[model samples]
Target: MAFFNREDIDNFDKIHRINLMNSLSGYKSANLLGSISPEGQENVAVFSSVVHLGSTPPVLGFILRPTTVPRNTYENLKETGFYTINHITQTIAEDAHHTSAKYDKGISEFEMTSLTPEYKNGFLAPFVQESPVQIGMKYLEEYYIKANDTIMVVGEIQFFYVKDEMLQEDGFLNLSKGRVATINGLDGYAIPNLFTRYEYQRPKKIENSI
Candidate 1:
């Protein structure tokens, strides 16, 4: 077994420390956040931090690293108040990951990579056409994380488009059916399978024993 303490992690090389820390949380959702600037310049970037905040209003959130550097997705979404979250799948994993490359502000990642952008129902932002699960999001609010200087941007799901076969009757999404990809670390991409589904659990009644 390997062990790493706070001091040990701090002493490691920059890349080593970053890779180790980013992977400690295990597999994360792989998504492509699509946004368009006010001037209609589209931006698509890969992210692993998108998370469900609530079901009542279908809220979701994703973290943005400290804005010391250029963050086109963050800038576009903030200005336009709209974005799209699209699930990355096995078929487009490579192209999706390529979006992580830092490009000039006006350059469209869609043109650089094999990924294609689709506009649905007159939504302001574009969605990845190859993604199985596509969600149109309206910006809600954001919280500043004092500890790490990151920002958590929250949004409400305005539109959801999922493949017919992937949605279960009870409202569960079977990601395996779509070959959805998950992030193992900063760069590793994997396609997970459906193991087994368990029903809601309740405490078992205890009986008197002789």
Candidate 2:
């Protein structure tokens, strides 16, 4: 057996190692923000900064850049108090990536891409019709992480639409099998190949407790 050392044959430093890992942790779920225009032109901008805050209250969160940047998503979420969360997949990956472009104000990324934006369930927020899963959410509280100049906009889910076949036998979240994509790093997306399905714990007794 051979042991490897990180310091010996390094092409990148420790910082690079950490940055790369954090950037490529996994492909992130891409979401599109929809809001009524100040001048009545509805718009959509794709974002991959979404996070799952909790499961009990079904909290979902997304991060946005500062107000000074004139980000439409930031404006819409603040103005409308609602948005749609769409899961990413291999099929929509290219279009999902295209949404990241810094488009002109009032320009609709939905029209530019192949994604179809549809309104359902009586909410003003729009969602991608082709996604395997889509969730409609209502605005919630926001908190500042402090260390980073970022704000977490948490939302409570009204209802989530999911494909029935994506459910696991034990009712676990089976995103990998759904071929749902994720953002690994800052600008890349990939589909994960799942090889493990069981939850593991440290001690043998932990298994019993679980």
Candidate 3:
């Protein structure tokens, strides 16, 4: 196996380093974050960093790169205090990926892409109408990661609009059944299926749990 130390990694070409580091962490959830400017211009962007932060409070967090550049999603979220996280499925994965394209300010990605924007229950932000699982969130807080100039934006889950049958009685989401797409690297898209579901394990029973 090829070994890359810190110096070697840092010296690698920018694109090479990005691909290597991004894929090194394995599959990440492919999602589209939808936000709207204060003026009502809708914006949607593909993201792979959405992670569950807490269950009791129903919080989720996503990492946003530095704001040195114009990040419409970040700016819109801060301005509106709301956003939506829509799961990328095989049907809309291509359109979802295109949301990552840098559009001119005030341009709506929904118009540029085939994906449709949907609003529900009077939520201020728009949701991807084609997505099977859509989550409406309220901005909670932002924490800066000093190590990487990125910010972890946390939000509270205010509403969920998932297909009824996809949700299990135990609250587990059968994402595999929905053909949810997972991101490999920056541009790689993959659809994953469920192999098995195992129960939670404790120390002594861990070995034979599955």
Candidate 4:
């Protein structure tokens, strides 16, 4: 087995260290965050950090790299207070990954890739037409992580659109049925299969030894 301590990881090559650190958390949710500038310029970028922050408020959060460089998605969402989170699917994995490429301001990733921008009910931000699960979000708050200089952006789910068949009766989203993609590392995309899902657990009485 391979072992890496703090010092060893710190001394690794830049690319190697980044890859190891990013993938160490295992498979992450692959999502495309869609936003529109006040001037109506649309931007979409692939992200693997989207996470459910709370159920009561239907809040979700995602991590963003430092703002030292230009981040169109972040800028747009901050200014407009709206964005879309779309689940990446197996069919659009390549195009979804391509959105990660840095582009100049005002350039729409939807135009550069095969993906299509979808607008519904006059929502300012667009959603990926090919995604099986699409969520409209309203910017809520953000926290700065001093340790890594990253930012955690939080939002409240305003609208949710999922394929009917993918939603189970108990309100569980069976992502495997929709063929949603997950990120392994920086560039690896995979479609996970469904393993058995256990029911909610409860503490059981211990059996005394005979």
Candidate 5:
């Protein structure tokens, strides 16, 4: 196997280095983050960093690029204190990917892409109509990671709009059954299939093998 230290990685070609670093961590969840500006303009952006922070209060977090350029997602969430995370399914993968293109500050990605944005049940933020699983969130806090110049935004889940059949008896949503897709590297899209489920392990006395 090839080994690379910090210096070796840093010397790689620009795009090549990016792909290596981004993919090194393996596949990441792909979701469409929906937000609305204070001016009532809607915005949706494709994000791969969405991760579960906790379950007690149902908190979720995602990383954002530095505020040096136009950051509609972070700005809109700060302005309105509400956002939505919608799973990217295989059916809408192409449209969802297009949302990442940089657009004008007031331009809505929903208008530019084939993805439809819907405001549900009085929620302040819009949700992707094409997503089978949608989560409404309220902005809670943000921490600036000076080491990377990126910000981590945390939010509390306010509600969820998931298809009833997709939910399992143990409260786990069968994501693969919904055909949700995960991201590889920066732009590769893939749909994972259900393989096998393992039961919780329990310790038991066993004879030693020498």
Candidate 6:
């Protein structure tokens, strides 16, 4: 058996861990980048770390640093309870990376990324029109971690839009042709391959079919 100690793991430091995490995109799930804008003008950061927490009641979440660095996203979500999850596809990867340029307030990153902001259902948070899939979220809870200042944000999914072709008859993601995007780090994005797919019910009867 192989074992590893949490502290003994050499890549445990923040910078090292973050860099190590960058390598996980190739193996783990890829997610959309999310951002929040106060009054629709704050050019905040773009995060590739967004994740879907659930579909029942539709939960979504992301992690953010807890520093007092004046994060516009935290403020916007706090004030408006609204944000946009923009899928980062292969084509828009460069622009998505550009969104992290640390722009000042009132500067629209959209102006430079060529991604038009979109609004739906009278909600003002604008998602990227180019995304094959986009979702609107409302903040629900914020939980803190003791070891670090990072916080986990939970939000409710209010609206979702996806390309018609991306859903199969079974209503699951047709990843084989979703034309979606995934990230590897601060600057890597790609559509991964389709490997084997199978039902995951375990504790099975033995068979020699193979």
TM-score of each: 0.97, 0.79, 0.94, 0.97, 0.95, 0.81
Worst 10 residues of 5 by lDDT: 163-172
| Overall lDDT per candidate, in order of appearance | 0.96, 0.75, 0.93, 0.95, 0.94, 0.71
Tens-digit lDDT track of model 2 for 12-31: 67777656756744556666
lDDT of 5: 0.94
* Best-to-worst lDDT order: 1, 4, 5, 3, 2, 6
RMSD in order of candidates: 1.1, 5.3, 3.3, 1.1, 1.6, 4.2
Compute the lDDT of residue 48 as modeled in candidate 3.
98
Across 25-79, the per-residue lDDT of candidate 3 in tens digits comes to 9999899999999998999999999999999999999999998999999999999
lDDT pick, better of 3 and 4 = 4
> Which lDDT tens digits does candidate 4 get at residues 31-120?
999999999899999999999999898999999999999999999999999999999999999999999998898689999999999999
Q: Top lDDT: which candidate number?
A: 1
lDDT of 6: 0.71
lDDT of 6 by residue, 94-159 (tens): 776787777676676777677777667776677787788887888899889778779898999888
Q: Give residue 65's error in model 2 in angstroms.
A: 2.0
Give the runs in model 2 whose Cα sits over 4 Å from its true position.
1-27, 38-40, 199-210
* Model 4 stretches with alpha carbons more than 4 Å out: 208-210
Residue 55 error for model 4, in Å?
A: 0.9
* Residue runs of model 6 more than 4 Å from their true location after superposition: 1-18, 24-38, 42-44, 206-210
Better by TM-score, candidate 6 or 4? 4
